[model samples]
Every structure is written in C-alpha cells, then in structure tokens.
Target chain A: MNRLMIELNGLKLEHPVMNASGILGSEPEHVDILVNAGFSGIVTKTFTKNPRNGYPPPIIVELDNGGYLNAVGLANPGINGICPVVERARRHGKPVIVSIGGSSLSEFIEVSIKAEECRATAIELNMSCPHVKGHGLDLGSDPSMVYTLVKEVVSTINTPVFVKLGLCDKIIESAGKALEAGASGVVLINTIRAMAIDVYTGKPVLSNKYGGLSGPPIKPIAIRAVYEVYREYNAPIIGVGGISSWRDVAEFILAGARAVQVGSVFMKNRRIVYEILEGLEKWIEIHGVSSIMDLVGLAHRV
Target chain B: MFKPALKTKTEQLSSTLYLAEFKLVEPVHSKPLPLQFTNIWIPGVDEIPMSIADYEEEKQVLRIIFKVVGEGTRSLRDRSGFFGVKGFLGNGFKTRGHDRILFVAGGSGIAPLPLLTRYCTIDNCIVDVVWGVKSSDMLFNIEKVALNPGSVYYATEDCSYGFCGMVPQVLQYIIEKEGVKWSTIIAVGPKPMLKSICSTIDPSIEVYVSLETMVKCGLGACGSCVLKPLPKLLCIHGPVFKCNEVNEFLESTHD
Candidate 1:
C-alpha cells in the first residue's frame, strides 16, 4: 500500500529519495530537520576515525550556472560520534546510512563495524570524495583498490555495504569490482575534482585550491555513469548528483537507479524533499503504476 | 552565492578595529538588513563571516568592521587585494516602533548596532547604546550614528571611559536611572557575554541576540554553524534571533 517504499538487499527505505552525505546530518537536530523535511532516508555526513577540523573559510563556491565547487576536507565528529547521531535518527523510524571514510583499509574496517554496531541500516564506503587525499577518488580510481577495500569491509560487517564512487577513469570497472566484492549497491558519481579561480584576485577561489564539483552540470555525467554500470552488471544502484527536481529523480530511476540522493540542491531549497515526493506521487498515480521500482531501467529497454 | 566586490577600501577604525568596504559585483541580499553578515574569504588564508556595519544599496557598496581574532582574521586585517565575498545574507533584524529601545553590546558586538540604530532612529524610536570595551583604544567615533535621547554610553574595563564596569551593570544603572519602561533589548558579543545578560535581565523584556559561530557554507547545508540544543542553523534561522525563538538553547548554555 505504501507506493514509495523500497527494499534494497537487506535495507528497507520508506521512499526512494534520501539525503546525500556531507549535506546536513552532522548532529541529531539536523536529522530531525531532514525527517521533518520528508526525506525517506537519512544519509549522514561521512565520518572518519577522528574529528577532522576540515578547511577554514573558502570551502565552497557556488558557480554561476548549476554547479558547486567545495573542499570541506571530510569533516566529521569521528567514529564514536555516530552513537548519538544514529540513536537520534533511529528514533525517527527512518533508515540511516552511515557513510564511512578512511585513508587505509584498517580505518575503513574499523568505522564500518562501528556503524553496524550502532545499528545503521547500511554502510556506505566513501571511496570517491574528490577533494580529500588518500580517502576519496584516490582509492576509487583504481579498481583493484576498490575491490580490496570493499572485500575487507564486507567481511567485517553484516550490514548491507554500499560503494560510493565518483567520476574516474575506470568508473565501470570500479562499480563492477565493488559488486563482485559483496557490496549491496553502488552510489554513482561523487563530485568531480575541480577548481575555480577568482578573476579579481587572479587566484583559485577555495582555500584548498582544489575541490569537488557538484550539481546540475554533473547530472548528465552521473546519468551516464549509472546507465553504463547498469548495462554492464545489472546491480542495485543509488544515484546522486545535480538532482534538483523530481523529474531528475525519475530520470535516474529510468537509467537504473533504485533510489537517488540530493545534495547541493538542498542549499537552494530546503522544501525540495517534499516537493520531489509530491511530484513522484503524482507521476505514480498518473502512470497507474503499482510499484515505483517498475520504472527502474525503463530507459534501457526503450 | 559568493562573488567579488568591484571597488574595495579599508580604514583602520581603531587600534583593534579595521573597517573594510566593497562594491559588490552582484548583490547577495538585494536590500541589506541589520545583523546580516558577509562571509569574506581571504585568498589562500581563510574565510570568515563579518557583521554588516553599513551599506549603500544603489551603489552596491557594503561595509564590514572586524577585530583580529585569529590567523584568519590576521590575514583578513592586512590583505590589500580582492577576496571572495558572499552574503548580506541571513535573517536580519526587523524594527517595531517601540517607545524605548536599548542596545547592549561588547567589543565587536557593536558592529551590527550602528546600522540597526540608524534604522531605529528613522522609525522615530528612542534608542540608547551601552557598549563595553576592554580598553580605550578600541573606542572610536560612534557619535556619527546617533541614538535619540542619550546618543551613546561606554563602559571600558580598564576605567579609561565612562562607567568602569561590565556591560550588564551599566545597563542596569541606565534603566534604573531612566526610570522608564524599556520596549526592547538587543544584545550581541561573545557567547558568555550574551548569555550572562540574557539570564540576569528581566524575563518580561523582549530580547534579540546576534550569535557568533564558525560558519562554513552560509547556505545551511553544512551544520558547522548550528545553534546547538536547538534544530536550527545560525546561517539560516539566524545570526540574529529573538530570545523566545531560541530560549531553549540559551537556557542550555546557562548550565
């Protein structure tokens, strides 16, 4: 009877829309806001082994037309920090995906087990954060490293594990390696490594000098990533990148994303989650569809 | 929403306070409001949010006055060239035609008051400012921004200025001496200062505060600048908040 409900491997989500990591799930109160905002799942800001102060100001640059350049340096409250955050989110009765980031295999396994211990619905390995070194795109770009990290983490935790990958040279190979290593799903296309230069100062805008680029400009790239990965492996996928409208969500599903995450767009419209849900509801009613998943890979057949 | 300022100017307001002016390439907040801030990025150094001291709407010029607090501000203090600027954003203060309005500020907390006082005077409201400073050198020509009945009052900790005491003590003395009901009170400064005044003051008085916190994104997407104990981000719900709106967080801070 709940048309928006979705079952992915071992995790069950209320709807197909979720908050992406690095957006607002840093504290318990932020979780409340996301829940009130009507997001079906709570995807937390990626957590590390220790507290990361991140970079100072100039961490983000909003581009002129549909893009965001950011280098937040994977700031989080640390692994133990997730206890209160997960406890608070569970009270709201929504699936909470704990995204874990690490510079090495031990850190990844360590954080993933902690997430499962905290009763996370799923664990997302942050393999493609473009800004941070050693942890993000550094490991994701190499398929063998993705295979090694995923295999080690999946063996350590019983919870459904997801591999979050960005745009890299061997993206399809990376996605395939993750699935082969026992990941439940793949989150396609983290922000691409990019930068912006201030014309006035004749210097790069962000303090880090280099950052990850996200938003509408990256949507087409994400769709291709999802479409290709689906065509090759037919694995469960969670799509994210430049998802500003409900139509964008539909597009991801047709391209074979079971669920989609929204990031930079939340900065522009806090009410977007509800708006997307309303629009999806109308689409389901109009299309006379009993299950939302029926739309997944529809574009592939056409 | 970060953009460059076309025309830039900086003036040393006091030994500690330096005022920077900019002609924005594009306005972040169309009509500027008091207590809102401009997130300034010092090229290769850091980014910081400074309270809007003044603005000329038609000219696209904005003014921010700040004191050096750390390495970031130190870099901001001496920077000569252009840097990224975002905002004139956040929920700013709204004025009601109250009979008597009192502003209690400490150090750089006085930054937002001048512009707000300007608006209060235009609405024909009686305004009084009780500002506290650590020493005399931090004090400057605030008389230009007048407060109707008693232009401005100072309480310097070093006894170099009027009323040698803390801001709250001077505030109490001013209210008792006036012997009239105050319509509103707005306080800003260090967290401890804002908390102490809020707790000691009469609960019946309407109070608003400008909170200080590290803000990264300014868009409220990052919870770096959250008003803890409450589900609000200062970048979104405030840099300015009514006492009633965030009473819980204030109460939590009291402990």
Candidate 2:
C-alpha cells in the first residue's frame, strides 16, 4: 500500500484523493472531518482579502446529470477567516492546500502570505471561478495576467503554489504560463460558465443570472483538459470535477493527473471518500499495478 | 435514483403561501424530528430545501409548506407528478428536557411548529404556540395548532387575524397575561422575527430558532446553508440553533 503514495513537490500523500476547494472547504470542523475521513489532502475554500457575503441564496441549481449550476459568488471569510481551517488541517497532519481568490495581484499576494503564515502545505490560486465579478474567470481568462499573478504568488510564498484554471480555449496556454511563472502544479478545470432558466417565470434560475457547472456533466471536459495540459506541458495536474467513484480517479490518473480532487460526489455522502479510497486500492491490487504512478499518462502512451 | 414522493395533495393557503403533502415510496425511520427539513427536487426544474410540516409514520406521508417567492417554489407548485424527495435531513429540535415549551413562528416558519408541539406533548411537556402571518388567509394548519395540548395564539401583520402585531410582540403579550414562565422557546420565521425573538425574550431562557438559508445539498457538502462569519452549517449542525449560540452571527446576517 505504501507504493500507492505519490509526491507533489515533495509533499507525499498516502492516497491521491483530495477535497475540491469551495465544497466543504470553508469550515475548520468540516475540514477536520474530511482529514479524518481518509483524504490524503484537503483544499480550503477560496478565501479573500476581505469577507464577502457572496450573492444571495437560491445559488445552486442541480442539473440532470448529477451536475450543479451555482453562483455562490465565492462567499468566504477573509484571509483572516481561513486561519482556523488551515490550522485544523495542519494539526491533523493532512496536507492543506489553501485556495486564495482575489480581485488583484496584491490581494492574492496578501492572502497567500497569510495562508503561508498559517503554515498551509500549499496555495491554490482560484483564478478561474466563473460567477464572481472582478475575480475568478475574469482573472484566469488572460494568460498574461495568469503568468503575472502566479509568478507574484509563487515568488512571495515558500509554500508550493498551484493555479486552478477554468475551461477556456487557451487553458493549455494558461497552464504553461503558470508553470513558467514557477507554480509547482496546476489544478485543471474549475466549473465551466453556465446558466439555467425557469420557463414558467421566463427568467434565469440563479440569482446572479449565471453560474459555474460542475459534476458529471463537466467530467469529460475536465478529463480532456487534463489530457491536453498533461500532453503538452506534462505538468503536475490536480484533476477535479464530477468524480464520484474509484473508476473516475483512475480515469484522471490515466489522463495525466498525479492526483484528483473529489467535489460534487461528496454531496451525497462524506463517507464516500473512504469508499472511493477502498475501491481504488482494491482495483490497484487486482489490476496488478505495482505502483499508482505507473498508471499516470498510460493512456497517452498507447 | 431519488426515492419518488407522491404529491398526495396541494393546498393554496394564500396568494404567497402553499401547503403540499407527499407519500414517500419508503417510510422514514422516525417522525422526522421537529423542524428538520428535506430537499425536494424536480427532475429538470430545480431543488428547494423545505421544512417538514408534518409526517405520519404509518402512512409514510410527509407535509411541506412553501411560499412562492422564487422560480423554484413557483415551479414546484406547477408540478403534478411525483418529485425526487431526499429527507429526513438536517437536525430538528431536541423537543424535550424542558418543563414548558413556547413556539414562536412567522410566515412559512410556522411550518414546523405543529410537529414540535406534538413531540413536546409526547414527552408530557406543556406546549404553547404563537404563530404570526401577514393575513388570515396566509394561515394554514390552524387545525395542527389546535391539536396542541396547551394553548395556541396567532398574530398577523395586516391585522387580519388574532393579535394585530408581530410574533415577538404577541409572544411578550402572552407571557405577561398568562404569567407563564416558559422553560424553552423554539422560534422559526424570517430573519427579522427570529432576531426580534432573540432580543425580546429573557436571555436566561433557553431559546432555539429554525433558520432559513440557501440550502443546496441538504447534506453538509454544499456551503450554501452555512451561516456567514461563523460558517456554521445550518443543514448539518442545525436548521435549529440555540439563540445564544448563534445570536451574534444571527445579528450580523441580513435577511
């Protein structure tokens, strides 16, 4: 089972499963639960320089295929608010990836420093959140800005940095810039921009009028993005989106992600993390794969 | 697959308020605890979190009351077929360990009080209710309120019903008139009413309030129902919380 351990810039994880940022990532107690639940790592919600109330409720709309369209507006406690979550993650000995979201490079730098100060294992810059104004996909869409932002945060923080990018035509280009800017890894495919409508009312469903799509509907797109990014840059990719089962984890690894983050699937049950980990381990043993690392990029070779 | 819930009946309580009953394909383990809620989803339409108005353990029938304030609830009212219902979710009231329990609710918050009253009665505690609404027409489940063993009071903002005032005002009025020293106060309503109840009630008395928030996955996975600042999950920790535990954060939260 030790052979299942994988390293991301010297941070070794017993399992390649992690909680996706912004799911149950806001609270320390919840993070503690995830840590004890068998995830090798946990990503905190995207914290900002100041607390944001986010958009008003009725934020989530469940799509047909286990997908969700949400415009939560990245509501989170400020940089100061995430310390407890980071602290709990640190105390539990689980690698904590502090996800930071800001409207500016300076805001990103400030929040990253605070996370590093809290002793987070890594920093995931949420440059690709689709629903928020003046942040998220707005910042991630420009490859040059992605390069500059990643470089500044990477330069400022001693903790390893990863850039989470949304689906865009220039996703590979964005990943390239972030890596060139000294990011330790890339978290591919934040939710894709999408919207839903209530025909009865003849109006948009979400309060913000738009949201990001996640879950199984976005899984294929996420796999494709990870495949393309890994094929071109061969960088460390943390795959996320629509991962519910052990097989999904294997697919991400085959697509070149060293590890995968599970989000929406946990909506049904948190204990599913253990189910996924157990299933992955059993599959690994039965398949006669000597090491989990051998599975990475296997699809690309054949 | 979502366990199918049959829409046994739907009643329009008012222009805004509605009562809908469903029979679950599978019965619940217990009468869903008082004020505990369920997530109701229509295949392609949307999912909305609602509180249990009543549940019959034998019949496997559950009741929910909703206000048609948004597209989701409006769409819910239009649907006739069986919907996907995920329940017996979220923490409801404890319903015991008190001598006398007083329930204060406003608008759709009145949905859960009847069940809580029933539970309190089962535990042999004195149960009283103070329900407020915008008008008399907005009131449903008057029969449920009547079923309580102790007393039931009503207040309406438009002066169309019992006491022509808000819930807290009538609650204060009842305490003064009946000379009842309540051991517990369980309040449910819009934010302002809950805040008012918090401020007006004796700080020494044990008080709990059922919260209304954007509940996504009724399980704690989605952060939608988490209160701001504290990040306490309303879906998990409670749709019910001690007034003192959440008073400060509740004060800071806008309706």
Candidate 3:
C-alpha cells in the first residue's frame, strides 16, 4: 500500500512531500536534480510575463536560527520558457506545479494560460511571495483583490488552481476569500517580511533592505497559520515553512496540511525529502494508520 | 554568514585591475583551501563573487584581484573601504591525480591562480603558469604572490612582455618546443578563452576551468549560479569543473 500517496481534489502525487517553488527548479537540469532527489511533485520558480534580472547581489542573508531572509525579486525565465520547463518536469512522470507571479491581472492570466497549455498538472498563483513588491504581498494583503484574482484565474483555465499566501493581518480571511472564489487548494505561508543590518558596514544586509524570512524560525508561526486556516473551513492546505525533518512533516499533517512543500532546508540537506518520506513511512506504520490522510487534523479532534 | 571586514586596502595592480585586501572581524571556517571563493558585498551597491587570490594567516587578511567593470567594483576600489564578506563558500579548483599541473590564466582570470599555485606547491607537485594579459601593462608583478613556482611565463597580445603572442599560442609553443607533457591544465578566463583552450589543447590532457557567474547565496540554496547540462550548482558542485563533466556549459555560454 502506498500510504504516502496523495490524491485530493483532482491532484495526485505519489508522496506528500514536494519541492517548494523557488528553491531550485529554474531550469530542466535543476528539475532533474529535484526529481532524482525523490520529490513527488516539482514546483518551478515563479514566472513573470517577462524575464527579470532580479536585485543585484546581497539578495540573501543567513540567520542564526537556520533561516534566511531573501529579496530575490521573483527572478525567472519569463512566460516564454514554459514549454521546455513544463515538458521537462512532465518527462519525469511526476506532477508539476508552475508558480505564476505578476504585478497585474493580465500577467497572471497570460502566464497561467501558457503554463496550463504546456500540460502543467496544476497552477500555483504566487499571491504571497514576500520579497517581490506589487507581484505578491501587496496583492495578497487585500482580501477583496484575492477573491477577484482567484476567481478570474479559476475561470480562465481548466487546471486546478492553488493559491499561495504570505503571512498578513488577514491571512485566514484572504485564504477564506480564495477558497470562496473557487481555488482548488491553498499553500499557507510564503515568508515573513524581515531584514538585517551589519553593525560594521552599518547598512542593511539585503540590497532591498526588507525581504521575506523562511526556514525554522517561521515554523511556529507557520504551524499556527496552518492550524487556524484548516480549522475555520476544513480547507485542503499544503503546508510550507522551515520544514527539515520527518517530524516536521508529521507536525504539518497533524495540524491539517494535506501535503507539505519544502524549501530552504534543501540548502542544508538535498536528501532531506527522502529522509522525511522514510520517517513518515515508519511513523505511520507504528501508529497503525492506513494512510497519511487518517492523521490530518488529528489535533483538532483533541 | 557575511561579516564586515576591516583594514581593507585597495592597490592599483594595473590600468584595468586592482587588488583588495581586508581582514574579517572573525575568522572564517578555514582558509578557502584549494581555490574556494567569497561573495564580497558592497553596501547599497552590489555584491560580487571573487576568487581568493591569497590569504595571510598572521594578518588574517583575504586577498582578491578584480577588474573594475561596473559600479560595484568602482565603489570597492577605494583605498580603505568597508564591505561584508561571506565565504570560503563554493567548491574551487581541486587538482585531480596529475603529476604536473599547468595554470593558464586570461586577464582577470588570474584571480584564482595565485592561491591555487601556493596549494599545489605545498602538495609538492610540479607547477607552471602561463598568464596572458593585453600587454605588459596588464602584468602586475604576479611573481610577488605566486612564489616558489617551477616557472612563471607571461604572454601578452601586444608582444610587449615575456612571450610575444596570445596565451594559447604560447601554450602550444611551450608544449611542443619543450616536448613536455602536462597531466592537467587548469584554465581560468573568459568563456571564449577557456573554450579556445579546450580546442587548442590535446584531448588526453584534462582541462578544468573556474566558472564565474552571479552567485547569490554562495551556499548553493539559490539557483542563481546554476550550470548547464548536468545542472550542477556552481557554488557547490564547483566554481571549478572538468571539461567533460560540463560539456554543455562550454557550448551553451558565449563570451
């Protein structure tokens, strides 16, 4: 029995662990590396309508808590690169989710159509990318805008739509609005807005000054975000935040994440996903559970 | 982790090239052994990747030679400058099992050659260098840094220095005239130069090139410096790679 298998709302994955968008997956070779590492799904870097060179260096800074603050500015190959990227990811026979980024509605709509036409298994609207302005946090912070954009994108394509949101004052409300607008699922927690300063240089570490923080430091917040979102509507949530171990996966599952996307941690351990899957397999075998689904929202019952 | 560097010194090596030296507030993991790199951050401007030309343990100084190409280098070329440094990051040149190693440097590509030569000399391997510059003006007394070399030869395009020709031509003459066989050739330079060397040298001789790309997280988390074909992250797999391993990288990139 493939206890780790995931099949939810028209989306199917051999395992619940996925490679989070933007950690890698910018090119076909990067995809091959992730696929070979045993991820059930491949999430490509978020794409804008045109190529962006991104911010000049000093874009990422490491924290003591095994986290990173980065303002990559949504650097991508632009929409025209969809065919080769989607085709390569599909070649591995795994589900591919192309993350879309844009400042306005047309860009999102245009990229989604191209990604969908290239046979992407699903489309992930990057409404929560923290580092890039106008493209993400600004769009996600507005609940009414979330509803409108999600609805417009949902009506434009036949592929399942997953809304990725960052942590904001009205995160739960925005997530509610997305689901209400016909989103198939939600990816909770992109990154928290943060920055660092060098005492010597006396300047902010990242060139953009403010960037999104990811990795272990945000776990507690991400867990609470996932917990609250799942409780409010019993919505299907894909958890992502500072996940590095099988125990982390178990935590997200118990908190109601149907599957989890991993980022940041890959920088430390490329094979962490396999370790997580193995650990999940062993944990479920011990719990006498038939599938990971059985453990979803177990915390809510308590 | 990038910390602020102190006592930074910038010396004009030539018209186009300059050498910057600074001491980190705290020691890095270890001296970037073999030929590792560091991402030097210029505040409010840009952070660029530089190969460690030399490091002095007594003074705790990190030395790098760079060309002033853009605003980043222009701001960094001050006599006493302040910046953040994070490294000994990325895998640098690792000498394969070769008895004799020849380093071929093209212009600013000479950045990694000094430290590489020092390490290889300690390993007691026969080492030779053929550094090609635009003219004698581009040669900046390299012997001062690359000491104890079996021999150091300079090749200038204008024929104003040691050898009167481009680096590849001098390389061919050296190989044929001396009837000497090199087990390995570590070439660092522009894409066209590295590619040309690949075509000029014998297939039996192994060629390893240090690739320069925009490296963001130096730790390999960001895909900013990803290489082609095998798709190895240059920060981790290498800033240095053998010709065969990254065949597509050479063919895909142009000068």
Candidate 4:
C-alpha cells in the first residue's frame, strides 16, 4: 500500500489532506462528506472567546477569475458553540484541528485553552485572517507579536501549536521568527489582500469595502511562500492556498509542505479531498513511489 | 433531517443552465416537504445554496435548478462538461395537506415555483402561479406551467407583454377580484419584492418566503446565511420559512 501517512509534532495522520481553518465550520454536519471524501483531518472554523457578529454583508465577492474575495470578519459562535462539533468529529475517528483566533493575546490563549478540552488533535492559531480590521493578519504580520503570541499559546497548551502565517512581504523571515519562538508547525498563505467594485453601484461589493482573496489566483503565491519558508526553516509546513485538485496538492507537497490544507476548494468541491487522495494514491503507484513522505520537498532538492 | 450527496452532471440545459441530478447516495433524513435545498460544491468555483426543484423518492434522484449567479455558479455551469457536484445540504421546505397554494416567482425565483406547482397539480391540490420578469424575453417556459390547469399569471415591469405590473399587484388583484381565499402564499423572488408582499399582507394569512442570503457551507455550520431574530442559518434552518418566524427579518431589513 502507498502509505500517505505523515507525522506532525508527534501526531500521525492517516493522510496529508486537511481542511483549512475558517472554511470548515464548527458543526461537522459535513463531516461524513469530509471523512468519506478521504480527508485526513478536518479543521473547525476559527473560534473566539465570545460570539462575534463579524462584518456586515456583502462579505464575499466574485473576482473576474474563478477566485473570490471574502471579508467574513471571522463570524463565529464562540468556543462553547464549537464543542459539539469537536465531539462529533472525534466520534468519527479522524484527526480534528481546532482553529482559534482572538483580538488579544489573552483571548487567543483562552480560546486555545478551551479548545484543548475538546477532542481536537491539535490547535491552530489563526493570527492570519486578512479581512478583519483589528485582528488576524495584523497580529500575524508583526514578527515580534507573532513570536510572542505563538510562544504564549504553545507554552499554555499541551496540543501542538500551528501558527498560520500570511503571505505578506518578508514571509520567510516571519515564518522563521515564528518557529524560533516555538510554533510546532506553520500554515502558510492566508487570503491575499484584494477588493472588488460593483460596476453598476460604482462601489466596493463587500461591506468592509476590502476583503482577502483566495482560489486559483493565490495558488502561485502560496506555493512560492511554502517553498521559501520550507527551504529556510525546514519546519513542517501546512500549505494552503488554491489547492483544488490532486495536481495542486502534489505541487504543494513537492514544494516542501509536509501536508496540505484545503479551503476554497472544499467550498467549491467537498469531494475534492477524496478525489485528491485517490489521485495521489494513483500517482504514487504509477510512479513507483513507496510513500508520500518521500515526495516532500522533492522539488527543492531538484 | 438532510444528508449531503455527490451528484454528477447528467446534462446541461442551456449555456447558462444545467440539468444536474444527484442520487441521495445517502439520505440523512426523509422529509415530507415540497421544498429541499443543497449546499453544492463545484470544484475551483464557489459553494452556494440551491433549492431542490424535483425529487424521485424511489430513485433517490434530487434535481436542482440554478442560474449562473457568480463565480461558484459560473464554475459549476462551466465544469458541467467536466467534474460535477459533491454535497447535498440544508433543511428543505415542508408542505402539508392539499391546500390552495399560490407561488410567486421573479427572475431565477421561477425555478422552485414550477416544481411546487407540479407537486400540487399531481396531488390534485389547488395551485396558481404568478411569475414576473423584467420583460417578456426574460420569461421561461410559461406554457409548461400554464398547462397544469391551474391559473398562471404573468407580469413584467416594462410590460413588454402580459400584465403590466408587479407580482404583488397581480396577486392583490387576483385575491381582490376573484375573492380567492389563498390557503398559503409561497414567494421566492428579489428580497425587496418578498419584503413588500410580506409587509402588505395580513399576518393571519399563511405566507412562506424563500430568503436570499449568502450561504457557504449550507449545513448551518457557516454563519454566512444567518437571519436576525433567531440568528438561524438559511442553509440549514430554511430556504423557506413561515411568515411569522421571519417577520423580524423583514422588519429589520426595512430599518
């Protein structure tokens, strides 16, 4: 059998496919689909210490290409609302990653601490949502703040801390700084800064006026960031961007992602996870590769 | 209860339309409702909510009617020639007993109205349809709907053809002139139109509105489709809701 299993901070996954945070919601109402579709792990929506209303609508806009710009403002039902989802996912016997985002260091720590009580296998610190006005990418962009945040969360939680980073300038330096401060792994490339104007109304489509872009448009940028950070730090990288198919996932793996997190694609095609896993298996068998681990960072060596 | 299923594109209806049908593959729950919706996924496109226009209980075939709205719809419409959908989601509309059912449709709102009309016709329930469009050219399959022996009214804003007025005006005229005691009013159209109809009508008369909201996951997981009052997600709670539970939503919009 082509073993697709990989290790992240001592946790073993059945496969390398994981749903990116924010894309998958707190309720696993779609878990059967995710599990049957062959995803190794599912990430819950970003949870906050308290319930947030997020931004007002039109939070999402369609770009000219098939990509999208979303400023959902991280609307979540709070940490307590996420427990049932975590329990349901655990019952399915698949790895579950709980994603938590906060405006302050204490909020982040509290949410992460709350998530530890659930059955989530790990906790992903979402210091990288670009659309929110006060939080998210702002916290991620500042290297010192990221390090301090990561160190604080990692020190408090027993579960592995995956510091999700944004694809801003000097991302490699930022990823390196995050690892130095003690992130167990890194999730590279949240949505890129973008906006869309309604030609008829002659105004921006999103309520926030500007949002973060995702999908095919960001794939190239995300792959570049993953390659740069992986080459520089050699820390486990959870590549997330525009991974819609197996080919995209393969590219991320080759670029040095230990595993890949899918967001927009899951929104577009829930079965994409299984299709990718099937395709990866087929590709591995055809190429006579013994395992997915052997393919990690193959492009970097070449 | 509802389950998510993977559906393949059996055929494309038009350049911008598709005839993709999915097998229940997995039936999360069997509901006795005439309206059902799914949170659909088109690879590399967008994820949005769509209503189940037709369903065959034995075959477990669920049909969804959608217009090419945005990136997700475009992607699904484009890739119908390639990869298809892989999720069935949301709580559908419930229709109980054979009552006088009036369907009001505008724009792509025409999709689920026809299905409801067909169901009511087969069940020998009284059915009437008021379909509106910007102009006559925007109208689709009026004959198919009119053939049911149930009254079919057409209205266009510009009055290129048919009645020159709005759907609510037509409905008001019918109720006033014919003295038709409509047991239920199910409306799916632009939010403003639905809002207008809800505001003008008496709350004692039953009215159900299929709300238009941004839906991503469609399983109530994502808060994208939440309406105020109950803070319920349209994807799971309803694409269709009784007039009272949603009066707060309509009231909030007016403010």
Top-scoring candidate (DockQ): 1
Off by over 4 Å in 2: B1-34, B38-50, B54-110, B114-141, B144-232, B240-255
Give all candidates' CA lDDT scores. 0.84, 0.81, 0.84, 0.72
Task: Please tell me how candidate 3 rates in CAPRI terms.
Answer: medium
lDDT of 4 by residue, A59-90 (tens): 55446587877777888788887677687678
lDDT of 1 by residue, A209-278 (tens): 8999999999999999999999999889999999999999999998999999999999889899889989
Tens-place lDDT digits, model 3, residues A1-302? 79998876879989899988888877788888888889999999898899987887787878766898888888778888777888888888988999999999988999999998999999899999887768898899899999999999999999999999999999999999999999998998898999888877788888888898999999989999999999998998999998989999999999989999999888778789889999999999988999988999899995
- Clashing pairs for model 2 are none
Which digits, one per residue and each the tens of the lDDT, describe model 2 over residues B73-105?
887787776776665778787766887888777
TM-score of chain A of each: 0.98, 0.96, 0.98, 0.95
What share of the reference contacts is kept in model 4? 0.03
Query: Which 10 residues in a row give candidate 2 chain A its minimum summed lDDT?
Result: A198-207
What are the candidates' interface root-mean-square deviations?
1.4, 6.3, 1.5, 12.2
Model 4's CAPRI class is: incorrect
lDDT of 4: 0.72
TM-score of 4: 0.63
The DockQ value obtained for model 1 is 0.69
